[model samples]
Structure formats: C-alpha cells, structure tokens
Target chain A: MTYIIKGDGSKEKYDEKKLAKSLKRAGADKHTIEQIKALVRKKIYNGMTTKELFGLAFREFRKLQPIVAPKYDLKGALYRFGRSGFPFEALIERILVFQGFECRRNVTSHGKAVTHEIDVKAKKGSQVLMVECKHKSKEHLTIHIQTPLYVYARFLDVKKEFTKPMLATNTKFSGHSTRYAKSVGLRLLGWSYPKDDSLQSNIEKYKAYPITMLRGITPDLLERCIKKEVLLLSDIHGKSPEQLATLLGIAFQKAKKIAEQCKVCELK
Target chain B: MTYIIKGDGSKEKYDEKKLAKSLKRAGADKHTIEQIKALVRKKIYNGMTTKELFGLAFREFRKLQPIVAPKYDLKGALYRFGRSGFPFEALIERILVFQGFECRRNVTSHGKAVTHEIDVKAKKGSQVLMVECKHKSKEHLTIHIQTPLYVYARFLDVKKEFTKPMLATNTKFSGHSTRYAKSVGLRLLGWSYPKDDSLQSNIEKYKAYPITMLRGITPDLLERCIKKEVLLLSDIHGKSPEQLATLLGIAFQKAKKIAEQCKVCELK
Candidate 1:
C-alpha cells in the first residue's frame, strides 16, 4: 500500500483492489488488470498524487490494450466528441440500438403548434421516445432545471407521437433539475445519474465506445466519421486496413492502426 | 423639386409631400410640419442626397418639437432599448395598460411541469394573457419560426392560468413564424404585423413612447431608469426638474432638459 493524494486534495492509502475495480469498470479483462496493477505498483511513491499514479497505469495500459485504454479515461474521451453535439447524438443513437431500439437521427416532427427538429426519435417494441441530447465541452457543469422544463414542454408538443421523453447529457444534473424531471416523469441520464444506469454505464455495458477514442483519430477525422455515420468502434470492426482507408478516405497505415484499436472494443 | 439620392442609392425628385407625410406619421403637428418642410426645401440642391435633406429637416424639427422629433426616428429610438429585454418588457406592460389591460411585469407562474418567469401577464375583464417581449438591437432582423414554437409551448404549459398568449417584438417576424403563431391562435405583435393593429401603430395611437426615445439618455442612465421601473416617457411627465433629478440620480440641468422633453409626450 502507498499513501496518495486524490484529485480533491484528500490523502488516502492506495489499494490494488480499488485500481482493479476501476479497470474492471472500463471492461478490462482480469489478466490485463493484473498487468496494469503490477505496472502501476512499481511507480508508486509516498505522497504521490492519484493523478500521477493514474498517468503511470494509463500509459502501460495503452501499450497493452489501446482500445481499452481509452475506456480508462472514458470521461475525457467523451469530451473529445466536440461542441456540435451531432456526434454525441450519433453516439446516443448507437447506445439506444444496444437497448433494442430503432432510432432515426435528426427527425423533423410536426408538433401541435410548430415543427421541431428532434435529436433522436427512438422506438422500442411498441413505445416511442423523444431523446434530447445536451452536450457540454467543459467538466463539472450541471444541466439546470430550465433544460428539463423546455425539453418536457417540447415533448408535450409532440405528445401524440412520443410516449416518453429522455434527456441525455455529457455532464451532471443539478439536484433541483433532477427532482423536477423526476416529478414530470422525464428520464434523465448524465455522467453518473440514476445510480446504476447512466450515460457512462450504458456506454460501458453496450461497449459503444466512440471512434474518437482511437489513437490516430483527429478531430477532423472524427467529424468525417460522424458524417459518414461511423461513430462507434464496432462500426469499423473486422474491416481490413485497405477497406477502412477506402471507406474513410484515409491512408492505409492510419486505417490499420485504427482497425487494431477497434478490435479490442468488439462486443463478444 | 431637385433630384436627390435616396438611402437605397437610387435618385428621385425631392417631394415635400413625402417628407410631410413621414413627419405626420411621427405625430408632428401641422405647424411644425410646415416649418420642417420649409427648412428642408431651402437646404435642397440638385444631386444632394435625400439623407442631407432629412438631416436638415430633423435638426429643425428637433428645435421646434423636441418631444415629437424622437418619434420621427421611432424605429431607431426603439433600438436603444438595449439587449437585456427588461426595459422592453416594461414598455410592453405600459402598452398593455393603454389597451385596458391590468398588467403584471416579470411574474413567476407555476405551470403543469415547470415554473416560468413571464415577461408581462395582463388581465382584461374575464380574459388573461401571457406576453413575451423579444427585443433586438440590430435592424432588419426577423423573429424566426423557432421563437413562436417555444413561446407557444411555454404558453401551453401555463394554459390553465392564461387564456391567450401574445408575442411582442421591436423587429419584424418572419412569414413562417407569423403563420405558425396565427394558425395556433397566438397573437403576434411586431414593428409591422397583423396589418393595421401592429406594434408601431399601437405605440403611435396610444402615445406609448419609451424613455429611451428621449435625448441625453445614455445606456447606463437608461439601465438605471429601467431598474427604477421608469420605462415610459410619460413616467416622468409633469414632474418638476428637482423631482426628476432625485428620482433618477442625475444632474438638475439634465433632469430639467429631460422633463421638458417629457411634457410633449404626455397622454391626453
């Protein structure tokens, strides 16, 4: 055991079990988790900050599994989806697919009063849902009550079509906003909202890591992928590097590296 | 009549009747109109721009009828309401009063799903109204369809408390926005909408000029007046210079000048 300072300035003893739990949450296999733990343990010193400790483990994890390493910094990786919210909406559509929902992105629905360009219209079984994706680039920001207010009002305008409304964000939700949304029965999903079920949890469970997580993916390249509807790692899974290069209009070597990263993120 | 360049870069013969008609629209008296006409006619020369002719007319009109001169540039004066929309909301409240409606400014009303801070809520007889005031500082910008969609959604949320909803703007509304608002039975008020009963016509008919139309009012001073709920030119009408100075925290001489200007805008 080693004493370490946390991100919030609190000092505590670092245990290997805690490190393994986080890796497990990122969907690392037991063997890879042990390898990362041993690699991190060698770099530990008294009073080392958790950040420095995380950096050590993250580097070695990346070398071992490039695909899963991005998942280790999942929150940071998601932030790379950029500010437009289109790619983030694309990610949400894929996650909904894992939940057995058929989705149409950017649907223009005529409401009771005016027409609205909905982010996503999802249909699961016999129920249809209105999904509003709110993306923020910064960390520690909270979705306020006004968002849910307007979102629920929008859903009400198209009530004849959508049976339920869901608000998904890259950040957290304020307590008041959460309470208000709950009272109105509007589903709320954020980084760690709803305890066991959240945007992060759903992404992990569905293995819907975005293509932006790949090492060679630049923002411009990621945007191109989003435009081509190749948002998820699985979307390019099992493709030959030559095929990826032709499909995405990239060089073969770059496509080869991205394809290798996508392999590990493939759902069994 | 000398040929003069118009604002649109086209040349036309200077028509005294056209100049007088505009002054009449600004509520200038017949005597003041004749004085400005004579003043502009003397300054006109062949190839002189209509802008130069109007400048001569406006300067003389200001000397003759200080209060009504601001109305000659009514659209430009309204643009000084600033970007905050608070003073504009205050103006709307006063205008509603002129139409026999008892109005409340910035009322927070609870809705079925969320609470909304309404700009102005008016009640006349058994009917209640929800008012949204949209103020733009730029010229020629139109309120698009999205505004009415959200405004009507907000109204629908609070429909039980209000019988109808009205949208008032300093600029014009796009044709699609107007059609959407009208189809949904929502009232649309702009610089010119709904034919004769537009915002400009109402302001002229009811003499509800904003305090910003007054000369010597700085942006900072106007903000102070808005905070004090002194929005209309009539709000300071009939007040002594000393009273105006104390109410607005300004110089005695400035207040005296403002008070003199306010006298002409007093409602009959």
Candidate 2:
C-alpha cells in the first residue's frame, strides 16, 4: 500500500476507495471516475502529500465536471478555515441569512438575569436556533459527547430567554454523540449530519459561499469586504475589477481572477 | 382496580407497586410498608386524589422513620416551590455553596462582545460550571429531550464567552434523556440522576434542604423568611420564635411551630 503525507507531515495509506467514494458523492460518472483514477495513478508518488494529491485530483475533476468540482473542492477548502485568523462565524451568519434565516453573530442579549454572548443566533419564521460552530482542520477528529453536553448545559441556564441549541462542526460527529444528541433533541449540523441539511448542503442550497472560499483572497482582504457587506462571491458582481483591486488593495490581475470565480456562484 | 386523580385532574388506576417502591426507596422497613399499605387501603374512596393518598401515607410513614421521613417528604415539598413567586434560583445558588462550590446566581458579566445573564455560575477549584435550573410544581413531569436541546443550542451561542454549561431539574429526567445526556457529556443534576450525586442527593448531602420543607411553614411564610435571608431550616435556628414572627409578620404561635420544625434540621 502506498502512503501519502498529511498536513502534519505524517504518513497514511492512500485509500483509492475513499477517493472513489468522494468522487461518487460529487456525482462523478463511471467514465469520469476511471479517468480520474488514471490521472491519480500517473501523478501520485511516495512522498507526495494529500494536499498535492487533492490539487491534482481537483484539476482533473474540474475538467470532468465543472459545476460539481468547485462544490466538492470548496468542501475541502472549508476545512482550511480553522487556520485563518478570521471571524468565520460571521461568514456563517451571512450564509444563514442567505438561507432566509434572520441571523446575528457575536451578539449580547440582556435576559432577565444575565447577559448572553451569542456566536450565531438565527431565526426562521417561528423557529430560532443558537449555533456552536466547531471548526477543525483535520477531518479525522470527531466531535464527541462533550460538545453537545456543554452546549445543552449552557442553553439550559438561559433556555427561558433564548433560542434552541445546536452543534455545528466542520468535521463529522462520533456515532455515539449523534445517537446521544438525537435522543436529547439537540440539533446537529456537521459535515455530513442530517443528510441533506449538512453545512455543505446549506452552502450549496443558498449558493452563498463565503468570499474566503475564493482562491486569491486572503482573510484580511475578505474581512474588509465583509465589513463593507460583500459576503458572498456573487456580491462581487456589480463591482469592476479595477475598483475591487483599489478597494481591497490587491493587484488588478488578482482581483479580476477572484471576480471570475465569483461568476460561477450566481444562482437562478 | 381503584382510580385516583392526578394534578392535571386526570384519573389513573392506583398502582400499589409504585407506592411500595417509593416507600422502599425512602428507607421504610417491611413492617412500615405493610402499615402504610393498610392505611392506604382503609382510606380508599371513589374520588380521592393522589395528593390525598400521599398525605395519608406520609403521616404514617413519618412515625416509622423521622429523619428519613423529612428527607423523603422534602422531595414532595419541593414540588410546591414553583408556586412561590420568590426567586428559587437563589436557593439553588446556596445549595451549590454547601457542596464546596463558589456560586453566583442572577449574575451579569460583561464579556468582550456582550453582557451575559447567568442563572448560576458555580466554581469548584479550577472548574467553573454554568447551571440552568428548571423548577417544577409537579413531580409527575420529567425534564424531557427538548430541554437539553434548547440548553445546548443556547450554549452554542454564548459558550465562547461563558463557562461550561449544565442543566439541573427539580424533578427526574426521563430514561431516554439520562442516557442521551450521558452520551453527550452534559453534566445533569435532575431530582434523581447520577443517582449518588443527584440534585435530591446533593440537597440531602449538604443539609441544604429548602425552608418550605419544614412541616408546618406555608409557602407564603417561607417566602417571607427567604426575603429576610433565611433560606435553610438551619438558618431558622439562630432566630427566636418572637423574632421570627416579628421579622416575617406571622403570628407568635406559627413562628413557634416553625421553630419546632427547625430543630430536626440540625446537621451532623
């Protein structure tokens, strides 16, 4: 079995089966799978990291399926959010708003007894949900029972004055946690939980992908745009590339490249 | 089969097995159980409610065991706490202190982003826990799954700015709920969960029994004492009958009767 280097410089077996599964999940056809497998075989080596392999695969995957490629790759890119010294929680606020939920991030509410500091509070119709976002860079780490318990416990203190409690993680939840949370009625939205209502599904459904997901934009530049209320890539459409470059202090060419990527985010 | 009315005015078949179990749990010997059973049988009528039956059994049960009787009966008296307009969360704050925890209730902390209204934030050594206390007037009602979910969701919002979250209920937790809470690692202190360390057990352990649990004190009189910083029956010990009546505006005879009950609360 050939091994691939990880972000932490550790080695692990490169499982073809895992790749095939991810590809299938992205709606790649049999012909495309076979073509991608050939490209992987041609490119991978003993010391190559999984990040390099993802870049190679993503390039080939994009050729086979353009629309699905970015969504699939964006899912991978999201895992990097943990590293950016950014208020990704704010980005999440924008996405929830796009999904038609009235959302506020980093808010303080004066309840009858104490003031509550909320990360993200979203309300849709009569339903209000308070979300705890756990962002992990590594996919292998699972959110165990501790998170739900802590969240539930906090919510209990202020439940009479606040919204419903939920746990959202970049990675998946442990089986035991999911079972426990469901039994307690704690809502969970992980990478793949709630099936069609996972984080990826919510982002895809709204087509309101965060500006940080774009290739050329750094977290600092993105924050400036966010401060100016330009949250989604689609929000960049009305601006000229020259103005975008000047406003964000990026090169004209880089700004144009980011604008090009935002074009694909336009929904019906 | 005989039927009895519940608090909701609903009728159900009287189950002697349940009564036997409760009697057994309260440390009743076999002879005492038989005596209580005989009395329950003699008092049977067409329209008697469960509350009436409890009174009949309690009077006899106390004769058999005085110390255990107060503790057991204290569990029953707690259900009436919800009816009093007094802030019982303050009582919970005192209980935590007796358990070797530093507790503050109805506290507001100004965090970096928002002000937090904390019901009870308790600290033991380096560990700090935020508690949500659910006060109930009926023993039949259990803290269900929706509670933890709401608690957890609210925690998700403010966890970043607060301490660890926990849930405490005046009554028992449902079987599914206990199992779920354990799985998720949420520290729970319902009337009878974590058996040895349950909310009821904690009250018993610390001798932090509520003043309302005194045999003759009414909720009205108790609320008045609570207003005067007299929370526990033990707190009643230092006051003379005359002073107690003067402080709370009750009759001298009623104050003497309350003083009589306070004698049993002398901690070991």
Candidate 3:
C-alpha cells in the first residue's frame, strides 16, 4: 500500500507496503505489519499533510515495540483524566489556593513521633489539614490505613493544633473501610470521573474572586457595612440577583455585599 | 444554618450548625467541614431537599486524601485523555480493534519461554499480537524496565510462527532506551496526554480493526480485493470501515469481506 505523506516533508509518498515488508524483515510479524497497515488506512484523510501522516504512522508503528507500551498507556490514561493540561498535583494546589487556603504538595515530615510524606498540607485560619493522594488503577483498592500514622508523624513535626486527617480517592471506598475511617476520625473524600455537579459546586464555591471585590474587606469589615445599612440582606425568595437588586434599589454588587455582611454577622 | 430532612425521616427542620458540630465531633477537620458547608451553600437551590449533604461532603472530601489522591488524579488524567468514558483497558482494545483485528485484554500466559500476563492480545489471520499496558506514576519507574521482560516472556510462550510482542506507554522514552529497544526489534508505542492528534494518528496507524470484520472473509479474498481495486490496502490510512466503505463504493460488510479474505490469503 502506498501512502502520500500529508505534512511538510519533501518525500511526499512512501510505500507503506514496503515499510511493512521492511518491518517484517526487521522481525515484525506479518500480523503486526497488517495491523499497522490497517491503522494507517483508517486514519488517513484527504489532503492530509505528509509530515503529519509520517509522524502519526511512526508513533503508531512504534507501539508494537515492547519498551514503549507502559509509558504510552500511563500518558494516555493521564490525558484521559485531564491531568495533561496541567500537572495534576499543581491543579490540586490551584484549587486549594482558590479555596482561601495555603497548600503545599508532597511534603515530608520526620520526627520522633512519625515519618510520612503528605501529598498536601493546607492551612485555613488556625487549622492545618494534611492531605494524601493516591492514583492507581481500579484493581488497586485505596484505604487510608496510614492516616493515623501520618497524623502522629505530623503531630511530632509541627505540634500545631491537630485537625482531622483527610484521605481522597478517585475510586469508591469499601463500606467497612469507610466505617473504619469514620471510627478513627479520618475524613474521606472520593472523586470519580467526569466532574459531578457536587464537585463542580465545591470548586466554584472555593474559587477566588476578583481583587476589586476585596476592597476594604477585612474579617470585621462586614459588621461596619451592616451597621451603616450600605447593604441589606433579606430572604428574597426565588429572586434573581438582578430582580432582587432592582427591588431593593441597589446594585448587584451592593446586594452581594449586603449578603456577605449578613453572613459574617450571622456567623458572629 | 438549618437543614430540612425529607420523607421517611422523623426530623423535619434540622440545624445545619448542629450537623456541622456533629461532623466536627465525629472528627472531621474544621477545614473539611468548612469546605463541605461552602459546597452545600453553592448547590442548595430553592426548595432544596434533604440533608444528605454529609454524604456529598464525604464524596468530595475523599478526592483530597493522600493514599487515594493518585487514583483520583490518574482518573482525571485518563478522562482527559479520553479513556475514562470506558473501562480503562477498553480504549486500548478499541484502538486495536479499529485496525481490523480480533483483540482480547488481560490474557495470562505461562510457559518455559514466557511467563507473564499480557494486557491485550490481537489477532489478524495467522498473526498474534501480544500487548502489555503499564500505567505507572513517577514513583514506579520499574514499569519501564518490565516491558522487555514481558515481551521476552511472551516471545517464548508462543510458537515463533504465531506471536508478535508489543508495548504501549504514556511516558516518553530515553534515547539510550529507544536505541536498546530498536536493537532488539521490539515495537514501542508511546502516547502522552491531551490527545496529541499526531500521536493519535500514529496510534491509529497500527491499531487492529475489530475481528468481526474478518467474518466470512479469507486472505485470498483480501488479496483479490487489493488486485481488483475493490478495496484499498493502505497502511493505517483511511482504514476505518465507515470511512473507507463510502469512498470505495461498497458496503462496509463487503469491504470487510474483501479485507478478511486478504488476511486469509496473506496467512497462507
């Protein structure tokens, strides 16, 4: 079979049949050659550039080699999972940052009490949260049997006020295992593929807002805003922000400001 | 913060603060509880239903755990790479099937010459292709070293006439390693995430088509198709039946028949 290279190479046409023959001669089985041929045939489009096609064909043919398969599969799986856009660990850090927390990944702590590498160390206000992450195939089960050990280790290292330990998995946990986690006071979080609504909501909720919104925003500033009636927080049932803002004779921002103040006041 | 319990539950109005305190009492970290509360606040719409927020919170929380973080991250990567929609191995198999071959996944073989479990096995006519898929993290560099052993093992198990060994990985190969593989005549396929079209095209070039296409077809028939211009036997180019049949002025069944016949003829 002849292949017309579609990319920017000078040699635009090559005999794929010859290539297969060469591969067979070079120790590729006839079946493997045929497989290669079929693959090439299925994907070639009209007006495809030669360089592109050759690169594509070369990579595909390479798969028949033993050394490249595992890494290829891992990379493939990673891309499928959306980690290709950004380093997965980095994305986690970004999410943590957006959530109004400071986070560190792959942190190790060593002390007389414990020795462990935490996937993430997060601080919100006075609380310190240690996070561990595991990425494995479905056949590999995830259990946070080491949570207590890590907690103990962290206790030895920082001696900060301890918060509950956190464990996360892409897969679901066994009922008994989850119960065990609960029994030990470890918090468990599971995330599956195709970001579900609840997860998305969490992401959105924690996302950082624009700096303009932060103007004069101190923890106690909400109290002043509420006292001055610069905003009014009310239960306007089933009203859109625009509708409610219009009814209250305020800008959406002012209404949102009022809501924020109310929340702070309520919390206090 | 008040929550409402719906249906079958004895309680109607439940206090959200009470629930948060209970979770805190249950050993949930303050940060996690806060994250959960934010998640609930963002998602709770008018007429918001039950207080199953704890379960939702638990699910979200699990993704952040260390022991399981890798699994979730990998899943996200796989989904991004387009493998998460199906069983992890199925995507690999599908690519092989697209090359017009009968493919099986996760086959175990044990023999004096070969003792290993192969991730995929593909057959076309007389040729048998053994594939091993390794999904590894940086922590497991050993996966890269294992491919050659797997190939050698597979090569030993099958009679020289029937078997061909292949490897697929998501990682890039080192120069020295690539040279070593080429020296041994092993086929190596590599893919990175984010679905590089070029790489995918390369993968497509070597992928085997579904075995069903070979039904009622013989190697001679395929050769005849090639000779008679009934079907084009090109290397992995325009090979998908749905695409090829239309261009060739034949039904996919007819094209498949011709191709299978060619496969049979080639085997002879």
| The candidate that achieves the highest lDDT relative to the unseen native structure | 1
TM-score of chain A of 2: 0.78
Candidate 1 Cα errors over 4 Å, as ranges? A1-24, A27-66, A82-85, A137-162, A172-189, B1-24, B28-66, B137-146, B156-160, B263-268
Q: Relative to the unseen true structure, what is the C-alpha lDDT of residue B193 in candidate 1, on a scale of 0 to 100?
A: 79
Q: Residue-wise lDDT of candidate 2 within B1-268, one digit each (tens)?
A: 7999987799989888889898886668799899999889888786789889888888898888655566658776677664653346766788778878888776675433234466788888777776777888766788876566545544554566456668887888876566556655568887777878987777767777777777766767766876788777777776899988898898998888777667656645
- Candidates sorted by TM-score, best first: 1, 2, 3
Model 2 interface CAPRI class = incorrect
lDDT of 3 by residue, A147-184 (tens): 33333323333344346566554445555445545554
Candidate 1 residue-wise lDDT, B57-161, digit = tens: 878888887766888777777888856867788777788899999999889989876677899999999989999899999876789876776677678778899
Candidate 3 TM-score on chain B: 0.39
Using lDDT as the measure, name the better of candidate 2 and candidate 3. 2
Question: lDDT, candidate 3, residue A66?
Answer: 35
Give residue A7's lDDT in candidate 2 (0 to 100): 70
Question: Can you tell me which runs of candidate 2 are displaced by over 4 Å?
Answer: A1-268, B1-21, B24-32, B45-49, B62-68, B82-86, B110-114, B157-163, B174-176
Residue A164, candidate 3: how far off, in angstroms?
Answer: 55
Evaluation by DockQ, superior candidate among 1 and 2: 1
Off by over 4 Å in 3: A1-268, B1-86, B113-115, B137-143, B159-162, B192-199, B202-268
iRMS of each prediction in angstroms? 3.6, 13.3, 18.3
Model 1 lDDT per residue over A23-111, tens place: 88776787889898878777788899987888888887787767667888777778877567788998888888889999998999888
Q: Give the Å shift of residue B175 in candidate 1.
A: 4.0
